[model samples]
Target: MNQVNTVVLLHTVLHCHFTSADSIENYLFEHYSASMKPRRNQNELVEIDIAMTIQTVLKVDERFQYISFYGWFEVQWRDEFLMWNETEYQGIKKISVPYQQMWVPDISMYYSEEHIHDLGVHPFVSVTSQGHVTWFPGAKYTVQCYLKVKKFPFDRQKCSIVVAAWQTTDRMQKLVPRARSVNEVKGIAENGEWEFQNFTYEENYDAEFDLTKIVYTLEFQRRYRYFLLCTIMPIVILSVLNSLTFLIPVESGERITYCLTLFLTFTVFLTLFDQTMPRNSIDVPYITVFVSFHLFLCVISTMVSILTISSKRGQECDSRDTQIVPLESQGEDLHLGEVNADGKRSGSSGKNYLRRTLKSILKEVFICKIDTVMLVMNFFFLGSSAFVLVICYIS
Candidate 1:
């Protein structure tokens, strides 16, 4: 019936020159309705040609797990009601004017973190006499994406954005890609932290929703130079220092202080770093493992330092007691006589034996100087940290 009307209008109105050129649009819009689908028959599905032209990547927030980008959606669909005979419109092939609330496909973003879709630059669409409508609406789109930071500053992340007609299933309308695939063709603004490697588009039928979802998987490699200089470099330096803590001579008595200081510093840094990462248990970062191992190293160093100091003090106390006993213990029997002066020989003998056994055991830990033990322990911890770093690289 619509084709018969168009045939009759072409014959009758094709040669009638209008007094005003505006009459062409007025005539075309007269047949357009905002609420009804613009198909010749309501049962005929409208195909919307969809494509994304990314202008730039605004930001990728790791703490919040979202990505923001400035882009335009190239949407084109046919409007059967808005078709016209070009000869009747003074040979005008196309027209660009304000969008007249014409029916458009109900396509939407499935992974939008916040709802802030807006019409770009006054909402105008170009319509050809053949009834093809082209609209490029641009906006800053924020999509919720899960980020993996196990490698931290050197990690590559994969995020996806779903474009689908959520309200209208595939049976109601079909979405056709304007191009073979989506990519960053337009000039992309460089991001300091994340490097846009590339993107791939997946169009597949979703069985659960009975809808075909267009998912764009974006791959990004972190620009690790900044992190290497700032975050990772410091961690490496601290790990090396933590291993060196044992080398501090126990004779100076500062090894204990050094171990405690490094432990506290690492703890503080770990706490600060935790705030910048997503709070999820799905994956533990290798950097965290590296730092934690060093922390455990600090604890072990502190324990060794304490035992060495205690052993040294015990020797000094024994030396002072020998000098005071019978003028430097001129005779062994004189030393025994002085120890049992309180007439509690049995109790004093038991105490002396236990003290000697404890000091003998402590001597095993130090022998003479605990520096060798500390160096060996440091090498072991250093090897463990290197192993963790290898894991981080492989991952």
Candidate 2:
């Protein structure tokens, strides 16, 4: 096995320029000297720049930001024999390599600690000159990261998964991600790693490279709890109320009133229900059926009441003579003049009393029959109303 040795290097550059008094410059120089002296060898910077490139493989959760994975390419500076020079400071002096291997720092573990609510992620590879001499001016680098589905969050039958790529530049702050249109440039899955099959890059120093972020979103249908509560509960209560109408007695004077009141109440309820539900000729809802039944009950009760009253009146007329007594028996007869002395004499004698008896019987029949018929009709009306309400409840 061939083994390659690599070195890690750290560098710091002063980004501030001082124009105001030399105080700032002097302070920076003293600070730099103090910090670098211990690590420096000889009278020069121990670090040198080399042409170094970086490629990273990072796995971050698109939904939750709790955990993540990161991997980076190993890089080190190599001695070049071809660049050796003859007579000037030439003792094959040990040169400092500028490229270093990247490692995860404890502070960079969770992004939430940085107060960064939004994140832009991309697979990036960058090349920079490591030596102070700036040997490689324009070498370019490329990197591509692919996502693999290990397990799905929901059942496949209920939902689907999608992956999309997006690139952000200064002009566009945020752009929606979309699936790659080119078939050849799509991601390739092998073993566990999904690789970008057709990714490519050309070396360039000044041009801005494309740094893109990719994201995936999942959506599904869910049942709403409020809809069930608002719609189903009231319907059940109305049905129960309709059923309770049967408990009323037939003899109660309020039977007709009760049935009619329920009918009207349900009509109002139906109006409310109609306002909520979409207008369609689809199968009638159970609540509507209940309302219709109550309306029918109202009609039936009314008819029966009318019929009962009519029948009672007829019976009363038939038994009127039996129900009433002769007015002559009270002894203050105003028709005394109308009855001649013969009639009175006959009335007193039991001989011609059959005619008087026949008249009395006719009068009693008329009055008694009217009274009987009215009583019967009232009862029949009440009884029929009760029967219909009971049937409505039972059915």
Candidate 3:
């Protein structure tokens, strides 16, 4: 009966166009109702093939864990009134119809994190007078996704854009991939921290939920040059400077002040860096661990300086005691009775030998010279830092 009506309408419309273009327009408007459903048979599923052309990637927020991009979504489906026979209409196979007068799919983005209150920019759709509907709509969206930042400055992350029908079910509609598979997208603005590596597309059919989902995966690698200059390089320079404090003379009384100042600088950097990272991420960034290790090295260098200074002061006190005792022995009269009063001469000789031996052992086992200890510390600090950097960048 629907086919017979279509044939009858085609015959009438062919003759009506001779009157005026409005006659054909009026006939189409009367034939199709916007309130009418697009599906010829309401119970059968209407399959929609979707494709996207990404204009630009606006921004990716690590703190908020979201991605913003500008793109247009192309949805192709079939409609009934839009179709016409070219032989009957003097080769007019397709025609423009006011979208307000035709029914469009109620497809919406699923898993959208930010709410866009506007109805979005709708454009005119091209349709064959037999009912093939092709609609393209532009959109700017911020979608929430999980980010893996354990390696941070040298990490590769895979983020995805998941889209599905908000209310449409498998029984009512089906989603399909475009013929070209995944289309190319442009990253218009260069990201300071991340660079686009590659992308892939997937179609997921969920049996339990009876829904079809589309996923587009974007993989990005962190751009290390910026972070190397702003964060990692500074940390390394500070670590090397802390080791330099070992070169300061203990007698100058400046070593303690210098180490404390460097330590305070590390504290400031750590605090600032924390604000830029995701606070609730399960995996701690390798860069954070790297900076923390350098900070620990600074603390150790400071403590060592304090200990060395204290040891030098103790040695001076012992030397003064020895000098005063010799002067007293000379003034007391070099007699056996004086010797007995002063304790045994044998005991004094033993004490002098032990003190010399202790001094020799300390000089060998613990670095007595500031420059020597500092040279060793510098080598160790730089070596360890380089090793960690290699591992982070390569893997």
Candidate 4:
């Protein structure tokens, strides 16, 4: 494998240079100092033109909020000391030089230390007779980024990578994008989780730090079809089941159990996805908030089920009463079972009044109102959840 790599590298060099004169390249660089910037004067500013193209975006870790990708950069700058007449060097136009023997700009990516592994490989530099230097190196880079997952599985994210000259002010090193057409990523390989979207850039000069940073902003759209099976479909199934709990008749004695089961399902799902969500305080995923609201509905549904069961038991006891019989559905009108022959009730009138009051209280408090209330609540909560999701996604 190593022999094949070496042969391929040699072929690439020969194919690009197309000249057999190695002596000309040596003589030009032999007396050159590759440690300092290629400036003719001490105070001259060296302008570095850079164009980067993302060949592939390998991974986007939303939980940890980082992106890993493979790409190459084209860096060009002019050196005053390396220029020579082509006629003096047998018309040699360009030559390859070892990258270590040339001075490269002190540029590094900002917010780049989250991962410690290095992905760059040393590459050769190309120099022309006019002292134009071009360095092309391909490598994989992982950088820190934050997640905006308010819409979650259906979300589009805007991430940025900042590149600037480290420990150098804008006066000594001026960076420029090669061209408007080439500044964006040339092309990208398909990723399973995220689809590549177009990118933009901003070059800002900070007067306080005397630094200029180029911020390349890239957007990624999540592949929501993948999440339909894993996330959205399950929530939908649970929501339907939760709403169906109210339709089960109270006499079947399964309404409370079913409602409680729905509640637990939502709980387990929320716990299962907790690690998948980014730990951000500002943007809470609408999916999370929606599930929480659904869980609250479950609690309400369970409480309604319990009230109906209790109301059924109390009504059965009230109907079997003989001492104080209720003639009205509300249990407000009641009288002694049989008045004595003397035409007066046997029990005290006050005792009869107290029984009427107690029965009326039970009838009014637990009257099995879930049918109407559940119908209205289901619409309210389900509609509100949809509204919340729409607002979050639109914003």
Best by TM-score: 1
Clashing pairs for predicted structure model 1, backbone only: none
Regarding TM-score, does 2 or 3 come out ahead? 3
* Local error of candidate 3 at residue 115 (angstroms): 5.6
Q: Write the per-residue lDDT of candidate 1 for residues 1-395, one digit (tens) a residue.
A: 99999998987665554432467678877766788888768888788888776678888888788999877788898888777787776787777767756776777787686543332333788888898999887787899999988888778899888788767777678888766433463246677777887766778788787777778788888998988898788888888888787667667878888889999989987897788877778867788878888888888888877877887788777655542222233444323223443433322243455566586666756646577867777988798778868876885
TM-score on alpha carbons, each prediction? 0.83, 0.25, 0.76, 0.80
Model 4: ten consecutive residues of lowest lDDT: 321-330
lDDT (C-alpha, whole model) for all candidates: 0.75, 0.33, 0.71, 0.77
lDDT tens readout by residue for model 2, 316-388 = 5545533222224334432211234234321243323555567556655644464355345434544554465
Candidate 3 residue runs with Cα over 4 Å from true position? 1-25, 31-36, 85-93, 97-101, 115-119, 181-183, 186-193, 311-323, 327-378
Model 4 collision count: 0
Residue 333, model 3: lDDT of 49
Error of 3 at 160 (Å): 0.5
For model 3, what is the C-alpha lDDT against the true structure?
0.71
Model 4 clashing residue pairs (backbone): none
Model 4, TM vs. native: 0.80
Q: Candidate 3 lDDT, tens digit per residue, 1-395?
A: 99999999998877666543444466667767786667667787788888766667787777678888777778888876555566655666666655667777666665565533322466577777677888787778777867777877777887777767766688888888685544363434456656776766799988777898888788878888888798878887887787677778778999889988888998888787687677774967777776777678778878888888777777767555443233124453432221333454433444555566588578545656655766597668767876976787677
